[model samples]
Target: SYKPNIAFYEAHGLKGWQALEKTIAYLNEKCPDHFTIADAKRGDIGNTSSRYAKAFFEELNFDSITVAPYMGKDSIEPFLEYENKHTILLALTSNVGAFDYQTKMIGDQMLYQKVIDISKEWKNSRNLMYVIGATKAEYLADVRKIIPDSFLLVPGVGAQGGSLEKVCEFGMNDQVGLLVNSSRGILYASNGRDFAEAAAKKARELHVQMKKILINY
Candidate 1:
């Protein structure tokens, strides 16, 4: 799977977006079976969200796009309208600031849990997934209780000091419902001429670890 956070490309302006376009095209050509996610974290009003949906799912041809669910169901339903495309809603993020709101208690559950419960009631929710930070691996057990079958896009591994082993141990469902990401760990594996090779090596390490976990499961 390939997840390209749009912010990285946008930082370089037009050239960056072009590079992003090329990257997506290359992935489509070389790994068509792989799922592609545009980690854009977009969400807006109904009309605006529809355009965002069209831009990512139609124009960009991403299999999924990350969205902020703070705007409520109307902002998210537009993305859910697309067939075979997914809307990855932010729940508990890896960043330190997330605790400001995400983990706050509301009645018997945390705010993030309430967000998940509410989002499940939105239309076409079967196409919905959640972004649960790998940094909070212990929280996965409680998260699974709310949505056991949903896939989780987990970031914060490697560079963020998240444990892949702990994430797999608590987050995996019958279908292995986890996508543990290690962006900086793989991307900046080396600064020399053999950068690509170094990145591949890093990826292989994670692959081997995942394989062992899967085998045990």
Candidate 2:
């Protein structure tokens, strides 16, 4: 299985990030079969992004990292350089604030559609993926026009109220290129020490749902 990108942990904080690392290690040890992601949403100028890439892909040993693309192609190129690793770029976000920019029409197409088109030019971008908010199911068909093959990390399922059936309906691909994330809905399922068990249970529910979704493809 693939990993859930950065927003999942950042919403927590420093302590939560630490918990994320420990969780990654535990999962890597116990469920080595599944891929791990550092949803860091990090991207800076020059060598800054390089170090961010190293911390997540090297030091933390995450299989992938989420990066912002607004700074320019160079800011994202370094993260894309990581071998066999994924770089999930923020395309269309799930929040209401997304209307502040993502939905703005630019001569017939949304701004995010242009970003997706331009990203195809970056180095080693074949490993590049996009962050598509699950709430915007209607936009998935349009997004598919730009990046039909690349994977998409979709958030806003349970707690955010994005429907699973709707996201899969528009986002599923031949390679099953959709990673639907549910963090608070999964992690904080309980306040007890059995939180990890609860998280696993939540993950299992999503996995079961994913299995059914995949069968349709």
Candidate 3:
């Protein structure tokens, strides 16, 4: 599966959008079996939310999209409405700032816990997945207790110094529930023309490592 951060292309305006469209087109044509994720943390009011959902889920033909949960169900249900698609909510992010809000206790539970617990009751909640930062491997146990069956899209595994071993240990479910994204660690493996080769090598190393862990587990 491929996850592209829209900001890198959106920063270029129309030309960027065209490029992104072309990229998605090529991926869909050549790699139909692979899942495609538009890593746009989009959420807004009703009409605006519907537009964003249409833009990614319909126009761009992405299989899933990441979204912010701050706006609650109204901003999210529009995305969830699409069948055979996924809406990935921000639960516990993989960043330093996560401790600032996500971990802070709102009552007996942390704020992130409340976000996850509440989201399960929303319309079409079965379409929901979550973004849990791999850096927060320690918190995976608590998160799994809430959504044990839902998939988790985990970032920060490579360049951000997150341990794959630790993440799998606490985050793995019966479904092998994880979609780990590593951007710079693979994409920037080299600056030369051999970059694709280098990137593939890095990805393969991680793949082999993951397979070993799963086999042992």
- The C-alpha local distance difference test score for the whole of candidate 3 amounts to 0.95
Error of 1 at 132 (Å): 0.7
Tens digit of per-residue lDDT, candidate 3, span 1-217: 9998999999999999999999999999999999999999999987899999999999999999999999898999999999999999999999999989889899899999999999999999999999999998999999999999999999998899898999999999999999888888999899999999999999999999999998987
Of models 1 and 2, which has the larger TM-score? 1
Report lDDT per candidate.
Answer: 0.95, 0.84, 0.95
Q: What's the CA RMSD of model 3 in angstroms?
A: 0.8
TM-score of 2: 0.87
Stretches of model 3 off by over 4 angstroms after superposition:
none
Model 2, 151-186: lDDT tens digits are 999988977889899998898888778888887778
Model 1: how far residue 32 lies from native, Å = 0.4
List the lowest-lDDT window of 10 residues for candidate 2.
1-10
Q: What is the TM-score of each candidate against the true structure?
A: 0.98, 0.87, 0.98
* lDDT pick, better of 1 and 2: 1
